[model samples]
Target: MIQKIPPGPVTMSDWNFVIVEYQGHVVEKFLGYYYELQHIRFSSQVIEYDPQSNTGKTWSGSKYFFLDRPGPLYPLAQIYLAHFSRNEGIRVRLKYQG
Candidate 1:
Protein backbone atom coordinates (compact mmCIF):
# COMPACT_ATOMS: atom_id res chain seq x y z
CA MET A 1 0.00 0.00 0.00
CA ILE A 2 1.30 3.47 -0.87
CA GLN A 3 0.68 6.37 1.49
CA LYS A 4 1.24 10.08 1.13
CA ILE A 5 2.93 12.03 3.88
CA PRO A 6 1.29 14.88 5.68
CA PRO A 7 2.78 18.36 5.94
CA GLY A 8 4.82 19.03 9.10
CA PRO A 9 8.26 18.91 10.61
CA VAL A 10 9.35 15.51 11.89
CA THR A 11 12.54 14.11 13.29
CA MET A 12 14.53 11.46 11.51
CA SER A 13 14.33 8.86 14.28
CA ASP A 14 10.55 9.04 14.41
CA TRP A 15 9.84 7.89 10.86
CA ASN A 16 9.87 4.12 10.94
CA PHE A 17 6.83 1.86 10.45
CA VAL A 18 5.77 -1.69 9.75
CA ILE A 19 4.04 -3.26 6.74
CA VAL A 20 0.84 -5.26 7.23
CA GLU A 21 -1.44 -7.19 4.95
CA TYR A 22 -5.24 -7.27 4.87
CA GLN A 23 -5.24 -10.17 7.31
CA GLY A 24 -2.84 -8.25 9.56
CA HIS A 25 0.22 -10.06 8.41
CA VAL A 26 3.60 -8.34 8.63
CA VAL A 27 5.29 -8.58 5.24
CA GLU A 28 8.44 -6.76 6.29
CA LYS A 29 9.59 -3.72 8.21
CA PHE A 30 12.60 -1.58 9.15
CA LEU A 31 13.78 0.75 11.90
CA GLY A 32 16.27 3.54 11.33
CA TYR A 33 16.86 7.28 11.01
CA TYR A 34 17.97 9.54 8.19
CA TYR A 35 20.74 12.09 8.31
CA GLU A 36 21.98 14.91 6.14
CA LEU A 37 25.72 15.12 6.23
CA GLN A 38 28.24 17.19 4.38
CA HIS A 39 29.96 14.06 3.16
CA ILE A 40 29.68 10.35 3.85
CA ARG A 41 31.69 7.46 2.51
CA PHE A 42 31.20 3.77 3.05
CA SER A 43 33.70 0.91 3.07
CA SER A 44 31.53 -1.56 1.18
CA GLN A 45 30.26 -1.53 -2.36
CA VAL A 46 26.55 -1.85 -1.59
CA ILE A 47 24.72 0.67 0.56
CA GLU A 48 21.08 1.42 0.97
CA TYR A 49 19.41 4.39 -0.64
CA ASP A 50 19.39 7.77 1.01
CA PRO A 51 16.00 8.40 2.52
CA GLN A 52 16.01 12.08 1.56
CA SER A 53 16.21 11.51 -2.17
CA ASN A 54 14.01 8.99 -4.00
CA THR A 55 16.58 8.51 -6.73
CA GLY A 56 18.69 5.40 -7.12
CA LYS A 57 21.69 7.15 -5.63
CA THR A 58 24.49 5.11 -4.12
CA TRP A 59 27.55 5.98 -2.13
CA SER A 60 30.93 4.49 -2.83
CA GLY A 61 32.88 2.42 -0.31
CA SER A 62 29.99 1.06 1.73
CA LYS A 63 29.39 -2.32 3.32
CA TYR A 64 25.85 -3.62 3.62
CA PHE A 65 23.87 -6.82 3.30
CA PHE A 66 20.92 -7.56 1.03
CA LEU A 67 18.07 -9.31 2.77
CA ASP A 68 16.50 -12.01 0.63
CA ARG A 69 13.95 -14.79 0.70
CA PRO A 70 13.00 -17.84 -1.36
CA GLY A 71 10.19 -17.16 -3.81
CA PRO A 72 9.22 -17.49 -7.46
CA LEU A 73 10.55 -14.03 -8.07
CA TYR A 74 14.27 -13.90 -7.49
CA PRO A 75 14.16 -10.37 -6.16
CA LEU A 76 11.48 -7.91 -5.18
CA ALA A 77 11.31 -4.46 -3.68
CA GLN A 78 9.10 -3.15 -0.89
CA ILE A 79 9.01 0.61 -0.76
CA TYR A 80 7.77 2.71 2.16
CA LEU A 81 7.42 6.42 2.51
CA ALA A 82 9.05 7.99 5.54
CA HIS A 83 8.47 11.60 6.33
CA PHE A 84 11.31 13.32 8.14
CA SER A 85 9.76 16.71 7.79
CA ARG A 86 6.99 18.37 5.86
CA ASN A 87 9.45 19.75 3.33
CA GLU A 88 11.83 16.80 3.50
CA GLY A 89 10.69 13.18 3.11
CA ILE A 90 12.31 9.86 2.36
CA ARG A 91 11.40 6.53 0.86
CA VAL A 92 12.46 3.55 2.89
CA ARG A 93 13.50 1.25 0.05
CA LEU A 94 13.77 -2.48 0.68
CA LYS A 95 14.97 -5.13 -1.75
CA TYR A 96 14.28 -8.81 -1.17
CA GLN A 97 17.23 -10.83 -2.50
CA GLY A 98 16.69 -14.20 -0.94
Candidate 2:
Protein backbone atom coordinates (compact mmCIF):
# COMPACT_ATOMS: atom_id res chain seq x y z
CA MET A 1 0.00 0.00 0.00
CA ILE A 2 1.05 3.60 -0.52
CA GLN A 3 1.64 6.05 2.33
CA LYS A 4 0.51 9.59 2.45
CA ILE A 5 2.52 12.49 3.81
CA PRO A 6 0.59 15.04 5.75
CA PRO A 7 0.25 18.58 4.42
CA GLY A 8 2.73 19.87 6.98
CA PRO A 9 5.58 18.67 9.06
CA VAL A 10 5.15 15.13 10.18
CA THR A 11 3.66 14.86 13.59
CA MET A 12 4.78 12.09 15.92
CA SER A 13 3.94 9.10 13.76
CA ASP A 14 5.06 9.82 10.23
CA TRP A 15 7.93 7.97 8.62
CA ASN A 16 10.19 8.55 5.62
CA PHE A 17 12.79 6.33 4.04
CA VAL A 18 16.24 7.81 3.52
CA ILE A 19 18.93 6.80 1.07
CA VAL A 20 22.59 7.30 1.83
CA GLU A 21 25.93 6.44 0.31
CA TYR A 22 27.47 4.36 3.05
CA GLN A 23 30.49 2.15 2.76
CA GLY A 24 30.59 2.57 -1.01
CA HIS A 25 26.98 1.40 -1.26
CA VAL A 26 23.62 3.05 -1.28
CA VAL A 27 21.69 2.22 1.86
CA GLU A 28 18.07 2.85 2.56
CA LYS A 29 17.18 3.78 6.13
CA PHE A 30 13.87 4.22 7.78
CA LEU A 31 13.44 7.27 9.99
CA GLY A 32 10.70 7.51 12.57
CA TYR A 33 9.03 10.67 13.67
CA TYR A 34 8.97 11.48 17.36
CA TYR A 35 8.41 14.50 19.52
CA GLU A 36 7.46 17.80 17.90
CA LEU A 37 10.78 17.81 16.07
CA GLN A 38 12.24 16.17 12.99
CA HIS A 39 15.40 14.19 13.54
CA ILE A 40 16.94 11.15 11.91
CA ARG A 41 19.44 9.19 13.98
CA PHE A 42 21.89 6.85 12.38
CA SER A 43 24.31 4.55 14.10
CA SER A 44 26.36 7.44 15.48
CA GLN A 45 25.03 10.59 13.85
CA VAL A 46 21.85 12.53 14.22
CA ILE A 47 20.35 14.65 11.43
CA GLU A 48 18.32 17.48 12.86
CA TYR A 49 15.95 19.75 11.00
CA ASP A 50 13.44 22.53 11.23
CA PRO A 51 9.98 21.35 10.24
CA GLN A 52 9.26 24.67 8.64
CA SER A 53 12.36 24.48 6.49
CA ASN A 54 12.09 20.74 5.78
CA THR A 55 15.82 20.06 5.43
CA GLY A 56 18.50 18.28 7.48
CA LYS A 57 21.99 16.85 7.36
CA THR A 58 24.42 14.91 9.55
CA TRP A 59 27.81 13.26 9.46
CA SER A 60 28.13 9.87 11.07
CA GLY A 61 31.18 7.69 11.33
CA SER A 62 32.60 7.71 7.78
CA LYS A 63 29.39 8.79 6.06
CA TYR A 64 27.48 12.00 5.70
CA PHE A 65 23.74 12.32 5.01
CA PHE A 66 21.90 15.35 3.77
CA LEU A 67 18.26 15.49 2.69
CA ASP A 68 15.39 17.80 2.04
CA ARG A 69 12.77 16.50 4.44
CA PRO A 70 9.42 15.77 2.77
CA GLY A 71 6.35 17.46 4.14
CA PRO A 72 3.84 20.13 3.27
CA LEU A 73 6.02 22.92 1.99
CA TYR A 74 8.03 20.40 -0.04
CA PRO A 75 7.35 17.37 -2.15
CA LEU A 76 7.38 13.92 -0.60
CA ALA A 77 9.88 11.26 -1.54
CA GLN A 78 8.57 8.12 -3.16
CA ILE A 79 10.29 5.04 -1.88
CA TYR A 80 10.85 2.38 -4.55
CA LEU A 81 11.96 -0.21 -2.07
CA ALA A 82 11.50 -0.17 1.66
CA HIS A 83 14.71 -2.14 2.04
CA PHE A 84 18.27 -1.36 1.07
CA SER A 85 18.83 -1.35 -2.69
CA ARG A 86 22.56 -1.74 -3.25
CA ASN A 87 22.17 -1.85 -7.00
CA GLU A 88 19.02 -0.03 -7.94
CA GLY A 89 19.82 2.84 -5.65
CA ILE A 90 16.95 5.04 -4.48
CA ARG A 91 14.38 5.26 -7.22
CA VAL A 92 11.73 7.91 -6.75
CA ARG A 93 9.11 9.20 -9.17
CA LEU A 94 7.41 12.51 -8.61
CA LYS A 95 3.67 12.57 -9.17
CA TYR A 96 1.46 15.56 -8.99
CA GLN A 97 -1.91 15.13 -7.34
CA GLY A 98 -4.28 17.78 -8.46
Best by lDDT: 2
Q: CA lDDT of each candidate?
A: 0.26, 0.36
Q: Report each candidate's C-alpha RMSD, comma-separated, in the order given.
A: 14.9, 13.1
Give the alpha carbon lDDT tens digit for every residue of 27-75 in model 2.
Answer: 4443544334344222223345445654434334222222434431222
* Model 1 segments more than 4 A misplaced: 1-57, 69-81, 88-98
> Which residues of candidate 2, in runs, are more than 4 Å off?
1-12, 35-98
TM-score of 2: 0.24
Name the best candidate (by TM-score): 2
Worst ten in a row by lDDT for model 2: 72-81
Error of 2 at 59 (Å): 20
